[model samples]
Target: MEVNPNEITNYATKFINILIDYSPKLISAILILFFGLYAIRLVNRVIRKIMLKRNLDPTLTKFLADFLLWALRVLLFVTFISKLGIETSSFVAILGAMGLAVGLSLQGSLSNFAGGMLIILFKPFKLGDTIEAQGVTGTVSEIQIFVTKILTANNQTVFVPNGALSNGNIMNYSMQGQRRADFSFAVSYDTDLKKAKEILLKILNDNPKVLKNPAPAVFVQSLTDSAVIFAVRPWANNTDFGEVSSETLENCKIAFDKEGIRIQPYLQELSKKNS
Candidate 1:
């Protein structure tokens, strides 16, 4: 069948009229989108500047700025779509459902992320500080969004989930300005208690690393069947806790040996017989 020229012209005219009727709406939507995006960008920039001026962390500042920008853009796009006569309630419902699904799937990770955020905001511990959390003790090397990295005393890197750490007891040793070093030693019953105490006190007093303000405590804590137990407690800087503790023990041994104070061993047989 041959197409009529008049009929083709009529079809073209109808299509052009439809386009003309929708053109203004489409242009208005495009312009709104452009202006909305620009406004979002400007708002994000202002937020970033304020955060910087307030001395916020760079990572947190960037995250907040980006999140705000994306949220604004999405809202703008939704508005633009609604202007073009598209229903957005169903779209919002779909988005909500998807978000709920994702949240359920990532529940553990999201909990950890929230815990990490709390840790950062509350600052229970910071990088390079020695902390004990979730039965693991180490120096915090980094604090991320989901996990905290720790460098153990033995030079091992350990990753602890932030959720467990935040919920558990956290012992931040570095937070204490000073630490106590408790050293105990057992001496033979035959040894003079006064003499042993004097020797230990001299040893501690000679150690320059020990704090002088708190002084040193040396006393007979207990008397067992085989020996008399003496307790020596000294205060030292937190940084030198391990070093001072080890050195104090070593020095006590040397001092006792020089003073002829023999460390009494726990003899089960002798104890049973005495009992």
Candidate 2:
């Protein structure tokens, strides 16, 4: 068989011409890739510094920075592909379709993650703070990207999804530094209202846990057929609220007993006996 040198030379020439024609674009793409990476890093750093200046939560700042970094890198890759004379619209469309599929599959998780981001950014409550949300009242034990851990009064740990928690109402008892302990004490209608109010007020004043600045209040809230309801409101530090209320209720019972003030239930029993 006769070897054709002309055909071999023609193939080499075509290969060289193709490489020469694409070299500039390949080099430009490489340069853009490096520059785009640097720019992404710079943007991430700037964003982190801004978040720090605003005193945003450290966890949230890191999460956002990382997310932005990846997003920018994806955009940079697409640009690099386009610069190299590659069609990118179809690639971008494919990526979008994949993203949408993943998003749909993890809709609840994405919602929770978004909620957690909002919680961390807005800081409605912090760790160790007592909060009432999603029908659970407890101290926040931990906060994560999708859930919050709460330590209930019974020592049970409740994991609440951040989606429902952030979207729902939150009562941050620890935010104000103090909370009002409300108590409803019913007394017999025959009992002296003035004396009962004095006793309740005295109880609040004597308790060291109670805050004096707000000044505890006692008023006749409502009158029933058998009793007068006294609404006692005492302000105390969040930490001492439970103790303050419990001790005050115990003290009230003792004081009322000593003062010969018959409570509503006792009068009810007496009425039943007489009838």
Candidate 3:
């Protein structure tokens, strides 16, 4: 069959007319898309400054900023698609379904993430803080969206789930900037109380790690069934707390031995019975 020239001409004219009808809308949508992306970046910058001013935790700040930017971009894309004469309600529904699926699949992780957000927002414990929680004592090294990394006392690294940490009691030892070094020493009942007190005080004063402002003290804490107990209380910087406590006890013992101050046997009666 011979093709009609008029039919081909009519088809070409119709296609051109369709293009002409859509050109302005397409161009405007494209312009808005580019402008929307630029505006998103600018908004992100402003958000960054605001987060800095608020001193929001860095991990949460970055997560929130990225989430906001991506969410805005998604909405912008849907707007652009709608402007191009495409239906977007289906797109919204699809996104919502996907989010729900993810939320359900990652229920535990989502809980942890929410807990982490609470930790960051409420400021219970921060990075580099020495905190004890969930039966582990460690310094918080990293705070993430789902977990917190801790460097334990024995130099071991622990990854604790934020869900547990946030929900549990956290003892933030470093927050107060100082800690008390508490120790007790027992001497034979026959030992001189004044000499024992002098020896304990000397140990605390000798160590520069022990703070003097709090005025270290050695007092007659109690009289045990077998011996006299003296309590040593000293203040020290939190960072030096362990060292100060250990050194004070060790040195006090040595000093007591040298001074002939008897550290009564813990089981003095048992020793006597055995003898």
Candidate 4:
């Protein structure tokens, strides 16, 4: 059969005309997508500026801005796609499924992040504060989004996840203006309690670091088979805790020796040696 050239030309012309007619719509869609992305970027910049002015934490600000910016961009893209005559129901469903999967996979991490935010907002403990949390006692070095960094008294760095910290009890020693230095001294049952109490009180008077307002407390806390346990509790500034504790122990020993107070020895050790 002979080909109809004129008919083929007519069909080609119609197709070209159809494409020309749809060109404006195509251009409009492209413009919408570009403007949507630009608007997202602009919004992110505005958020960042506001956060900076408010003196918000840099990490949190960045996280919020990025999260919001991406969310806005995705919304805009979806709108653009729908405007371009694509069905968005399947897209939305796919996004939902992906989000659920991600949430499940990162549940622990997300909880930690939330816990960190709570910790930062509440100001429970700040950097450089000595705290005991999650069974670790150390100076807080940094509070990150997922983990809190601590400098241990032994000079080791510890990274504790925020979720565990937030869930557990926190003992902030630095928060207290003054801390009590508690010591238990054992004396022979025959030793005079009045003389020992007087010696302890005199030692407290000599130590200028000990706070005089609360006054030092001395009492016989317990009577064991081998000795009488005397409790000595004194208040000192948090900064002077270590120094005051060591000094109190050393001075107590010296004071007891000078006052002729005898320390009770371990009776079990004597029995073992004899056996």
Candidate 5:
């Protein structure tokens, strides 16, 4: 190669001039980037405190905090790059394209994720709540980001996807603190409906688990082909609901036996057959 001292010197001088012009700017950008990151973290902590004090749903609070932090960091990075005189439009376009691709590839997963977010934010039910949803009735043992786990009374564990759970009808039995025990009792049509009502009332009144203020109700439900049906409804604390219901039925059978009251159809048919 032929030696070109003038050209080499000119290239070196241009390079030095460019570095001199950009050096201070690069330092400033670097300082701002570090400080901005620290500031973002401080702001995030303050946001967490505010959210906690406001009693914001914990899931929502965590997600919002994380999203905001990432967004702020992205903005800070863009600003730092722009300070170095680089265009940011291309970066934003690339980000949008990536997001679109990811969304397309994970449609079902995204749906479940969004559903979970809705449930957590809205709080239709919580752990320990006995809820009926998606064709099962159980106590909510756990609520995860994408699924819910329930323990059924029959000692079965069910895993329901959040997408279905959030969209499905949820019947929360434990939220009300009290539950109604509805019992149907039948006597032969020959038996007095009034006496049956009295016996049912006495059974309900004697049970300590049954509520008082709302009061128990005993009413003639229907006159079926085989018997006269009576409906007994009693209110009890949710914790005592099962016990109250079972004990009431057992006691009623005993009392009816002593009082010569028999349930409809069976005894009547037996007596006719004996004759």
Candidate 6:
């Protein structure tokens, strides 16, 4: 076998020429890639600061920033590839087709993501809000891209899909700042209606937690076979509602006992009728 030294030298010369011609583009592309990444980070920080200064929701602000960061990175990637003299139209078409395929395969997940975006943009409910939706009542703990985490009264954690939550009816108890506590008490037919109303109203007035603006009321809601049903409605701040109701009930029972306002038992009346 004869060694072809001139052929090997020609190959080496061609390689050097290709490297010399490609070096500028390669170096420039690398620089652009690094600068683009740094710029994306800077932009995200600026946008986040602006959003926070405007008092936007923290969850929403972070989501938007991340979305923007990825979008910019994708664009920079396209630019980097194009700088290398590689065709990008076909590449972008491939990306678009892949995205469409992914979107179709994840229809339900995409719906949830869209719902999350709507929830963030529309401000339906915020973190720590006590809301009732999808037959569940709990305080919102976390707002993610696909699901909302809730802490229920029974200490159970629930993850609710944003798609169903956004489309369904939501009752926000904490939004109004105050809530009305409804109580139904039964008294014997012979009991003094005026005196019962006075006692209930006095109980509400004495409680500092009860709101004074709406004014509490006690009225006969209905007449049952065994007793008269009195409706006691009181208004209080949402935070104080439970305590106010509990204390009011306790005080009312004591007052009723001291004043001889008889609360008849339903079974006792039925037993007497049978006897």
Best by TM-score: 6
Lowest summed lDDT window (length 10), candidate 4: 266-275
TM-score (all chains, Cα) for each model: 0.78, 0.74, 0.84, 0.72, 0.75, 0.91
Candidate 2, 1-275: lDDT as tens digits: 88799999999999999999999999999999999899999999999999999988777888889889998998899899999988998998899899999999999999999999889889999989999899999999998899999999999999999999999999888998988877678888888899889988998998998999888888987898878988878888888888887898789889999999977763211100111
What's the candidate order when arranged by decreasing lDDT?
A: 6, 2, 3, 4, 5, 1
Compared with the true structure, what per-residue lDDT tens digits does model 5 show for residues 1-275?
Answer: 89799999999999999999999999999998999999999999999999999988766777789889999999999999998888899988998999999999988878888888888888999888888899998899877777889999999999888898898888887887887777777888777677777888998999888899689888887777888877777888878877987887788788888888888643211100111
lDDT of 1 by residue, 1-275 (tens): 99999999999999999989988888899999999988888899999999999998665676678778888988998999988778999989999999999999999999998888888788898888888888788999988888999999899999999999888888887876777766567788899889888888888888888899789789987887877888788778888778778888888888878888898763111100111
The deviation in Å at residue 176 for candidate 4 is 2.6
Clashing pairs in 5: none
lDDT of 3 by residue, 119-238 (tens): 988989888999889888889999988999999978999999999889998888889898776666778888989978887888789889989888887898789898897878888898
RMSD, every candidate, angstroms: 6.0, 6.6, 5.9, 7.0, 7.1, 5.6
Tens digits of lDDT, candidate 4, 1-275? 99899999999999999889877777888999998888888889999999999998666777688789888988888888887778999999999999999999999999999899888778788878889988899899988889999999899999999998988889888886777777778899899999998888888778999899788888887899889988778788888878878888889889889888887762111100111
Candidate 1 clashes: the total is 0
lDDT of 6 by residue, 196-261 (tens): 899888999989998999988778878988899887787888788778878977898899999999
Q: Enumerate residue pairs that collide in model 4.
A: none
Off by over 4 Å in 5: 1-33, 80-86, 120-122, 141-145, 154-157, 264-275
C-alpha lDDT score of every prediction, in listed order: 0.83, 0.87, 0.85, 0.84, 0.83, 0.88
Better candidate number, 2 or 5, judged by TM-score: 5
What are the clashing pairs of model 1?
A: none
RMSD of 2: 6.6
Candidate numbers, best TM-score first, in rank order: 6, 3, 1, 5, 2, 4
